[model samples]
Target: MSQTPNRSYADIRKALLAGEETALLDVREEAPFAEAHPLFAANIPLSKLELEVYARIPRRDTRVTVYDAGEGLAERAAHKLRDLGYVDVALLEGGLEGWRAAGGELFKDVNVPSKAFGELVESERHTPSLAAEEVKALLDAKADVVVLDARRFDEYQTMSIPTGVSVPGAELVLRVAEIAPNPATRVIVNCAGRTRSIIGTQSLVNAGIPNPVAALRNGTIGWTLAGQQLDHGQARRFSEVSEVTRRQAAEAARAVADKAGVGRASLAQLGAWQAETARTTYLFDVRTPEEYEAGHLPGARSVPGGQLVQETDHVASVRGARLVLADDDGVRANMSASWLAQMGWEVHVLDDVPASTFTQAGPWQAPLPALPATEEITPQTLADWLQEGDARVLDFTASANHVKRHIPGAWWALRGQLAEALARVPAASRYVLTCGSSLLARFAVAEVKATTGRDVYLLAGGTAAWVAAGLPVEEGEQHLASPRIDRYRRPYEGTDNPREAMQGYLDWEFGLVEQLGRDSTHGFFVI
Candidate 1:
């Protein structure tokens, strides 16, 4: 194979400063990518390249650069991109070390850009915040206060402030009025850590909400450090908005979007943007997953506005691509577009569209490369093969899932490292590949067959299908062919994280504003 072209840190930084379209991808597992990377680098691990590349970097001709920390994954990823029809793939000169040598600032953790922007917003606006002890005193005294958790509902259910209601970030501006009702009621917003709480509280302040609002400083991390107990399995959520509240919220959200210089697009204009072959345009439905699954605009991906802001690189890999947002409730799209615009994206809110216009139903379907037809096997038939010891099952599901439950004797394998994994498994007459839904495994059938020169078959519906058939399964790490590095466990995610890790995470966030100053390419502004 020919060598991929190398791009220096100066070259990539110049394009970003010029506002040109570029994709700076870090081809390492999430754990390593989270340790340290350049400011604009998006984590697209080499293992899941085929699964995510087409949908993320939509325009094949978009300038793309891939890098890794001296692991030799960059060249492999560049070669894979070429095979996938990407014409402008290149390797970052000197890899991660090279970027450091060139004086590029390295950032830690996922969603660095959004986290930095949140800190910047706080510094510029002096957004009001209350310490955990103060908030606890108010709760103890039964003051006229309402604590709204701005993290996802599931996260809230895991561990939340006492009497904290689940009101995700995007829903803050839309639902805060009804939740607080009286203008004198004090409102408190919080998340597991700092970013969401700051952004959520600032959203209400920016929209001119009547209530006295403040973020729970350092979020749940602060609460825990103060020796406060958190309520688990809480289900309190925002109720339906009144017609009067809806109108007020819509007006407030629109004004905020306008102040941020966010653009508006009619359905006709959106169609024209979608039809452009030269420019990559992403249409996102910035609503709750339930609302999106019930009905959404065709071609719109269901990315809750809060998550879309937090994980911009994950959803829209192309840095300079145009973003179009949609929501039945007028407040969500506008509020979300405002933040995207502040983040230096050319964003537009889909305006004047009726709720009935959202005709698409069910979950978002990702675009995938066409697969060659592969032979299939039924769950029962696979059971027979396993019983006869004639076939080796290669499960391509996530390592965590495989450990939780999998076919009795199946070996867990990563599709990207199939060659290495294959050598570890005992020789068998045939191989059956499977995953959660067999989608990923189908894409690997050709490769597995070519490598082993053996008959390879796909499990009709993957391991999920086998479970549905009431087939016996077992759980253990007895047959892992590849290491479990696909996902990075965030220190603030689950309930059992160590206290030291949580405090360290808070300290890291407190320093983000200074980091943003050092890396001046982030064109962030507060309205």
Candidate 2:
């Protein structure tokens, strides 16, 4: 977060324009990263540095530049990279503000590159779409048209067109025929924004679905802009696919995947890829998070196919890494692979694998790595500190989690703005930090200690440990010290976003293709 001699935005632009390999990183949380950032900047927040960096940016000596919006997080992140043996790490001169000052454009939302690529797909392939007015007329007339919302379940529940059922992009080809068995029935695919709708509609066309299909142009944004009513609290989801439907969907998806040059890998082939230590191999299960949580292949992380395509950089930061996707139904994996392959990743769909291969079940969370140097205080010790009133408790976990439950009397603070918030707080002799797992609190220890010149300690296992120890805790948004700016409030995320905000969001997405042209750093290719 401190200023130092590092590469300017111009330097980064020169390298990108020259086709040189570079990793321009934004060392911040996803929310702010989604609010505004460079088109090609990969976000690897400081809290997850140890957990994700090695796999994402594998080569230690690879040229890397880190930046933050003067938040003081970047310098520590750069140091962590060096400690991990990265020899060519530096800060971005002027951070986000500097980039703007130098006439570099900032884009909103996660996965801008993938979204831009989707726009490119539509530009080249001429994916067809219908205006909100036209779709509204069909719904009013009760035409035999099935509308599919190609977004995550929660997103669909937020706001959707009338009579639209949830059928995420990955499931479009797999479930379209089942939804519209009559060949004469019309089909409509839509999402919160443009990318998923366009890509989902195109997937149905590429898979050769029986029904005539089109996207709800510009998605919910366009619907709202056109003064069309949107349904909220919708719960309808796609029905279970029959064996016949599954077979048909697999054949349809596979043909498109083959045409897109996506590879088909066996479990043995995936094992071979995993054995290559020098290469980064990401194994993902492209199914709904609920399905993944119920049962999934061992070592395969849950990244639903639709979200994976929309957020490729978020899941796999290493551009050239080998990606192997798995899904019990096969269609989602294959369809997702087709898009990823064109995005310039060496992607494969695991084929002919039985459900028996998914021996692991229940909820899965990534294991937390140990944080050295910082002393950890047990829950019992923290209880005594609370009773004695000598230590100030600060919870660095998400506000949503804090609202559910946190240590009694602990003030919630954003990790990136801890220093700024500490200045306004009543200084304590001892400062103790806690989060859901305490992994993030460990990263904050040094910064808090430096800023306050007080003793700092991490809650051994975080709030979860405190609960496990049967300690009393408070519930609700109590004792808050910082605002929840860690993440941006997405217009398509909740049930209550204003129509104007939604329209503005659509306007932002509409201009991304032009922004992509200006940046010209993203190495995206559409098939």
The numbered model that scores best in TM-score is 1
Q: What lDDT tens digits, residue by residue, belong to model 1 across residues 115-212?
A: 98988889899989999999999999999999999988999999999999999899999999888889999999999888899889999999999899
Please write out the lDDT profile of model 2 over residues 225-278, one tens digit for every residue.
788888999999998878998998998888888988999899999999878755
Top-scoring candidate (lDDT): 1
Report every candidate's CA lDDT.
Answer: 0.91, 0.84
**Which stretch of 10 consecutive residues in model 1 shows the poorest summed lDDT?**
365-374
Residue pairs clashing, model 1: none
Q: Which parts of model 2 have CA positions greater than 4 angstroms off?
A: 1-22, 30-32, 51-63, 85-88, 93-105, 354-356, 372-388, 400-408, 442-480
TM-score per candidate, chains pooled: 0.96, 0.86
Model 1 residue 304 lDDT score: 93
The clash number for model 1 is 0
